[model samples]
Target: MSKKHKSEHHEEHADESWLIPYADLLTLLLALFIVLFAMSTTDSKKFEEMSKAFNIAFNSGSGVLDNTTIVTTGEQMSKERENNRQPSKEDLTKEQLQAAMKQEQEDLEKLKKQIDNYIKTAGLTTQLETKLNQSQLMITISDNALFPSGSAQIKPEARSLALTIATMLNKYPGYEIVVSGHTDNEPISTAEFESNWDLSSSRAIRFMDILLSSKKLDPKLFSAIGYGEYRPVDSNANALGRSKNRRVEVSIIRKFTDPDKSQNIPATPK
Candidate 1:
């Protein structure tokens, strides 16, 4: 009976030892499954945090999660670099503004050249002049070209010249044209007109009417002004100087004048 009791006690001890190893195996399997789940997830940042927690709990600083944090940091840095490469709105707007200004300058230069060529070809250099200034493109016509002495009426032959000028001007739309008339410092008292102001004003209106007669010309873009004897380009002391002073001007205003250099008038004379 003593031998049987000792055998039972030994059997109990062996069973307890087997149960301890089984519990250890189950714990190892659970840890392995947790590591696999963390690796399969797409969030590298979260995986890195979880790995750090596990390292702290296990009192070990080495794991695969360290590599995951490096990858996450690299991705964030790459995104920042891409954002820096993008252009801002102010930069794009500045480039576009420069391009537009350049295009406008070219167009104005071309138009000025065309007018100059016409003036040279027509043998009207003495009776006509064109100037491109910062404020406007001015085409000056001698009073003898369009009117007689002490008269506001435009000559019959001058109508054809006005028509030709209108045709050329119609090619460039959206520009404001000011037809201004100036007289010499000679007082006029006639049955038709009272003073130089009335004569100059009447001449300007008549010329503008002829220019606006074209079907392609817009009347809204044209205006008439009379400077009378006030704005004289030359002294009215002699006949030659008076002739130069008595003139009609057609001015095409600039669309985009530079604000910084607005007062600087770049004169291209012809």
Candidate 2:
């Protein structure tokens, strides 16, 4: 009877082996909680090392925290996005330059229209002409309008015209202005002038001086050039053509131009 009681007691202490795995599961849960707490306070490098150690001890590098990335600040994320999307410095400068060129072109067109209207209203179309080219807005005045034959002196009546032009020019500043003189092939040897070169040069200087008389016009921005019989628009063989060839030109030079467009006038004439 005692032996029968011992066998029953042994049977009553049944399935104690299952506690081993249950304890292991609880241990793993505790370890996972610990890993989460450490990750919250630690940097990415140390967290990665700890994660690796835990993974090796538990699941051979395939643990729950295997692919987690470090959290970043809002500023860092914004900077990354900006780096991906922002234009380069060169591209920004090119866009700005293109816009400036476009604005310059528009301003030149407006100025040309104003000068043209003035010329028409003053009945000076035959003696004055305005042309808008890629390089400049050129105002051409016949020599007979500004000067007498064989003379570099400006006509007294033309002083008012020059003053009006200078007033109009004062509307736009910081532009380089060139007053160029052209002459026919007629030879001139006067007391005040030596050759066509001297006559043309003096005429240009005289007209430029009138323009500079306006205090608003910058003297440094103005220049005078004389193309004596070398750059003629008409033939010296005829009276009308020679009259047309003798002229003075005022050019408001462009500060900016489109690179893709063709230049209508030489920027610097040889």
lDDT of 2: 0.80
C-alpha lDDT values of all predictions = 0.78, 0.80
lDDT by residue (125-201, candidate 2, tens digit) is: 99999988888899999999999888888899999989989989998887999999999998988788889999898
Candidate 1 lDDT tens digits, 1-270: 999999988877544668755665554454455556667766576567656544543453333343355346446656866776744324457567556555556667778788888889888888888887677888999999999898888999889879988988888887889999999998999999898899889999999999999989889989999889999999999999999999999998876655666554333444
* Among all candidates shown, the one with the greatest lDDT: 2
Candidate 1 clash pair list: none
Looking at candidate 2, the ten consecutive residues that score lowest on lDDT are 65-74
| TM-score to native of every candidate shown | 0.62, 0.63
Question: For candidate 1, what is the TM-score?
Answer: 0.62
Model 1 misses residue 265 by how many Å? 10
Question: Which parts of model 1 have CA positions greater than 4 angstroms off?
Answer: 1-94, 262-270
- Candidate 2 stretches greater than 4 Å from native: 1-92, 263-270
